[model samples]
Target: MATPNTAATPTFMVFATLRDDTDFAEFAALREDEQKQLEVLRSQGRIGAHYVSPARRATFVEVVAADEAEVAETLATLPFARFFDAEVYPTTPPDPAEIAHRARA
Candidate 1:
């Protein structure tokens, strides 16, 4: 059965294996694309919030997405995210953006 795209709510796991280490340029190319997607995600009314768990700069991640597939194909599958293996698991009241923002500071 095809999972319904909740559009408004669901967890999207974004993960990827390095297709090639020498592909450094690959990630650089999509830097702007990533920010654009974040804008799309917010404007589309998909995610209420989201966050990541970085394991040693690069590894497994658990992302909260409005749709599982959306996170993988759109966010995590991006060049910047292609380095880690990710899983999208349901999080009640998805992680707060404030926490991530504060962490950056």
Candidate 2:
């Protein structure tokens, strides 16, 4: 499987919560389409990981893009996107040296 080269571009963590007024039936109806689009993004190396918390009605996705606007543009393609209140956060891997120092402290 192809993966995004995180060294070449920025990575973002998108946290999207389903609006309280969202219709569960409508969300379910659009699930298949949403999955298809997600698969496409994954194949294109635009997405790294996708996780959901059904109990909390929230989703967390790792996105690879140049900026937050690009991340939003990528997510906007999802069928259920209109129902989401999304926040995009820039992310970086933890520094290994810091981790080692902390471990020894």
List model 2 lDDT by residue over 31-52, tens digit each: 9999999998877767778999
Would you list the clashing residue pairs of candidate 1?
12-65, 13-88
**Could you estimate the TM-score for every candidate?**
0.46, 0.81
Which segments of model 2 are wrong by more than 4 Å? Answer: 1-6, 93-105
Give lDDT tens digits, candidate 1, residues 2-96. Answer: 23224234454333444445366766687698667666555544433444444433433334344566555555434466544555555454346
Candidate 1 to truth, TM? 0.46
Best by lDDT: 2
- Candidate 2 matches the true fold with a TM-score of 0.81
lDDT of each: 0.47, 0.80
Superposed on all Cα atoms, model 2 deviates from the true structure by an RMSD in Å of: 6.8
